[model samples]
Target chain A: MSKVRVHNLFISLDGFSAGTYVTADEPIGDARALFGRFDGRVINGVHHVAEPITADRIFASAWGQGIGAEIMGRRKFGPQSGPWDDDDWRGWWGDAPPFRTPVVVLTHYERAPLAFDNGTVFHFLDADPATALAFARELADGGDIRLGGGPSTVRQFLAADLVDFLHLVTVPVVLGEGTSIWPGTAGLADGFDIETLTTGSGLTHQFWNRRR
Target chain B: MSKVRVHNLFISLDGFSAGTYVTADEPIGDARALFGRFDGRVINGVHHVAEPITADRIFASAWGQGIGAEIMGRRKFGPQSGPWDDDDWRGWWGDAPPFRTPVVVLTHYERAPLAFDNGTVFHFLDADPATALAFARELADGGDIRLGGGPSTVRQFLAADLVDFLHLVTVPVVLGEGTSIWPGTAGLADGFDIETLTTGSGLTHQFWNRRR
Candidate 1:
């Protein structure tokens, strides 16, 4: 059976996953500070979730953990404007990013195949959340399929009770406002069984394996 | 007169400010990532130096132009077993983590201070290089003082020479890492004018006047 895991999802105290006024200069707001300790690989994870097609698979193979495929939304791919421009704006990561698996980008905009150096491809799928998950499972081979999100996209899956495991890295600072993971939604559980909680530097890393 | 300016410091490509072995649980060894984002604070002069203190005056007035203090040092206050822990730890941050004006800590240990909460007594001085500049002037009153540091501590100040002004956020990252700053013991340049630099955060602003 295939399972979906949301790893390294960062959130502000106010519940926002990201700030509203996100420009190329300041994509994640003060959240960038939260990522100060991450290396290029983890940093690439953000872009991988947004546009999995452009990721490098050989690097994924190197992990040995075997991440089969990725899933993300349109806003994460790039600024929601017209057709794909010159491809100059390569999803934030520098020339050669880390994701090497098949990436399914959730989008309403229709576009042709976007290619990059190495063997990375950008596939724009206008499928529903279920379809995206199914496609990721198919692409995963026998490995695990992951859901990469920008709040709204993840909320869709969470609302339907799709996510199996979640790891949220709770940073100390609060943004006061931004994109939230759980908004007006109701019926949240009383408590979650914590799998692991460790403190490194100042950031707290917590993992929860849902008890279904 | 002396001034202090906090600038982003360099950290290892890894998320570590220094190395791992050092922590409150085990304060020593390879803990460089602790200070990786030191230079991030220079732009717009927005340095984020965390201080753990109990003095309200220090917290209420560590920012603005020309008025503050600088506090730092390595093993001066860290784990006991490390080679630098010659005696009881008395962090250079002073009885209140220095910086009735501003404070800068350059170290490999990631231990929170023993006391800090009421006033601005003790601040957790991270590895931001410009912190030294921001601290000196703020605490200078009109006179200049520099807190000499171990190797990593002084190297940070020398790399930017932001220390118009110099002080050691030096504690002990290692007891036997050869020479503290850089390998050679050569002194700084003659024309390297030592003047003061100053700025203010909501807390206590600082001053960094030259020492000529």
Candidate 2:
């Protein structure tokens, strides 16, 4: 079955998925160090080194495997918010994006779908989590739909109970403030059995699998 | 060498040290389940059963190994707010309080020190973390002073950068709203090297050793 999966999402020790004062200068707020621990491959991302395989690299490399399409928040799509005026701004990743699969970017301001060279397509959708998941599910083509998040997006899909699995990498730093997963996720463990995987890099990968 | 310590402190997957709405009916709010993971002694407490050894039991048993004196937030002392009207209420523990050493309870209202049958003597002080630590260190008699917490209290000590070691047990559960440890703890990880120990019981014990 095509499951909705949130893979390799790194959060602060304080449970903040992001940090404060996010701008082009610090696109992910002050969460640069926190997210830096991932060094994993996102849909549209960097870091494709031939370094010896560590647990981080293994998990980071496995990020794009199996998943077909992706659904992300507008924030994850770009630093721009509200009406997108920057015509040249495609995404954070230059040229070839990481998520080679079709991606549904949840946004209020809709635009025509964008196509990248490496099978990466950015489809902007002005819809809720359920509506967006439906759109992504179809594009997934029987494969799992990866919920690429900036935290709020993950929380939305998780709130709708649409996520089949959520893989969270807990970084040991404290960001203090940012988009958090626990804001509305009370009783999240009720449906999922948690699996803990620790790496030599001090990153604890927690998998929340929806129980049958 | 006597080092300050926080042992067996349980935090939810979402980083909540305690849940909201802490009352007599629910002292830790919805965090009862989260904290229930710790089977440690708390200044003369329960569950002294000699069952087969478990990871939690091991950590709980190690809790009082070298601790001399203890300092805790007013919340951890009791559920009563404002002033202490109940002359009969010693603490949550049934009689022979846990700490065989002097205990300091941080509170706004000062009270005459209450002595227990055991060496556990409760002193109410409206003092800051440094002041309390100094008092605790003296009472510790060159032994380690345990920083007993309810989240916010730990945060206060952590913010002061007085905590030499923090042994946190990561319990895989989410209590959406509660007192958190992230706020005002931005540069905490800079001085500590975190080591994670996962038990068969699904509890991840994180030992943060403060850099010398």
Candidate 3:
């Protein structure tokens, strides 16, 4: 069965998934402390890595396993909120984006799909969480759909009970105020079984798997 | 060389130290999920017990070490707001209270001190965090003062930069709404060094020591 999974979501001790402000200059704003220990290498599988992968890295490396397509919030694509006035703004990534699959960007304003050389395509659509997931599912073929988030986007999917697996890294730092993923998820644990592991570098990795 | 320390302070994944509502019957209210793994045997010490001591137990056992006096908020003593209309209402603890030293309860109304057989005395006083700490220091007699909180009290002491050491247990549960200890505590991690350990039982224990 094709599942919907979220991986490597970093949250502060105060439960802020992202910083309060985000601009073109500061992508994460005041939440830089939360990602101080993030290892981008973990996005890929851990088996091929030769750098003596730690438990934290191994846990985070589950991002791209069998995921065919991704659904991301408009903010994750760029800091621009209103209409996409700048047609030149491809993304934070250069010409070659990381995801080698169809990426659906949720936005109110419509834009033509942009295709990259590495099989990465940006499809803009103004749809709800379920609708976005359905679009991603069709694009993913038989593979699973990855729910990429900037926090609010993930909260929407989580609120709609569409997530199958969630991997959250609980950092020790505390952000006084920011966007939270746990605000409306009061009884979220009742439908999911959680397993936690704390690495030597002071990172707590939590895996929430939806009960069948 | 007395220090102000907070221990066994349980916080949910969303950073709520306690629940939203508190009454005479439900002292913790909706925050019961945060205390599901709390083992009260560790408050005194980890030694001399027949049960196997885990890292979490050793961490929580620091609560009573070198703590001669305690300072707690009024809500922690009872759920009553405004003036204490009920004189007969002592506390949640029966004849024998836990603290074997003087406990300063921060309240607006004036009332005589209540003495327990276990050397626990509840002194009601209307004072700020500093004033309350000073009173507890006098009663402590050079021993450290433990900050007993219902969340708001700890936040006041924390905002005042009076806490020397804080031991927080990050539970896996998520409380959607409640009283948080990190609302106004932005940049709080800059003042202290944090150490985190995840126990085998899936409890993440964090220790914050204020820099000298």
Candidate 4:
């Protein structure tokens, strides 16, 4: 069976997956600083090459591994609300996205697929989590499907029980206000076995795998 | 100066300090099962014996140490709401309470002091956080004051900025509904330096100490 997974998702101490005040300028609250700290440490989130690899490098390097397709909320694709007024706005990742996979962006507006040089193609889909997962699975071709999140998007998939493996990192800083990842996920850890590890960089890594 | 501290405070993965639907039948929101797993591990919470000292034993043993007094919400003292009505009701801990210190119970209804064996004494106070802490500190006799909790009472003291050290444990269970400890505590970790450590018992221990 093709697995659905979430990896390298960072959250604040208050359980906020994305920061609040999510404007076009500050897309993910002010948590951009938190995620941007690992800019040079990881190259396309695959391999790490340094004199001494830090915990961030070890965790961030596994961002994209063995993923065939992705399903993400439209907000994660851009900051604009309503219809796509800004056709020129590609994404935060610029001309080349790191996904390197066919990404399904869940949205109300239907637009032409945007293909990037890095094998990242954003396909807008007006479907619920089950439908999106089914559509994404067809694109995945028996490979795993990644749940690219913007908090609200992740919550939907989690509520739909589409996630098989979850790699969540708890950053110590409190984001004050932001989008929460636990709103609809009440019994999220019910059937999943969890593994926790505290790294030297002061963050807690939690791995949850759903029991078969 | 006498310090104010919180130790061995357990929380669920969803940031709930106490469980939901708390009543006289289930005091800790049916979380007694979560806490009862540590039975017979620690002698008095500060000392450990057994051959292999696991994480649960290590964290459980530190329940009470170097404390002159404690401040807890009335719910922690008893399951009864509103006025006392039941004068014979000592506490959930029975005749010999584990706390061998002066315990201040916050409540709207004022009641006389109920002293227990093993140096435990429950003083019901209808005062606010600042006044209650002042009174508890006086009884502490220059020793540290432990802030015992049911979530709401702890939030009051935390909001008043009276906590100096907090040792919180994150248990990897998803309690579907519970009283949260994160309300109104946006930047609680701002001034405190945090240390995270995962133990073999599948729980993450977080130590937060206020910076001088």
Candidate 4 residue-wise lDDT at A83: 86
lDDT by residue (tens digit), candidate 1, B121-173: 33444456665455445545563333434335656665665555321122212
Q: lDDT tens string, model 1, A101-187?
A: 766788776567566685445677888788888878887776565677777788887777777656565666677767777863466
Indicate the residue-level lDDT of B14 in model 4: 80
Worst 10 residues of 2 chain A by lDDT: A44-53
DockQ of candidate model 3:
0.03
lDDT of 2 by residue, A50-149 (tens): 1232335434544554578999888887888889899788888888887788999999999999899989999999998888888888898877788888
True contacts kept of each: 0.00, 0.00, 0.06, 0.11
Which of the two, 1 or 4, has more TM-score?
4
**Backbone clashes (count) for model 4:** 5
lDDT tens digits by residue: candidate 3, A45-131: 322221232345434544555678999998888989898889988987788777889999999998999999989999999999988
Clashing pairs in 3: none
C-alpha lDDT (0 to 100) for residue B167 of candidate 4: 74
Label model 2 with its docking quality class: incorrect
Q: What does the lDDT come to for candidate 2? A: 0.75
Who wins the DockQ comparison? 4
Tens-digit lDDT string for candidate 4 (B143-212): 6788888688888878888888777878778777778777888898998877677766766777777877
- The digit string of per-residue lDDT tens for model 2 on B1-212 reads 57778877888888887877677776667777785555552332222211232334434544454567999999988898997898777888767777878999999998899898878899999998999998888888877788888788899888888888777888888878788877999988999877666766778877677876
On the 0 to 100 scale, the lDDT of residue A79 in model 3 is: 87
Q: How closely does chain A match the true chain A in each prediction, as TM-score?
A: 0.77, 0.92, 0.94, 0.90
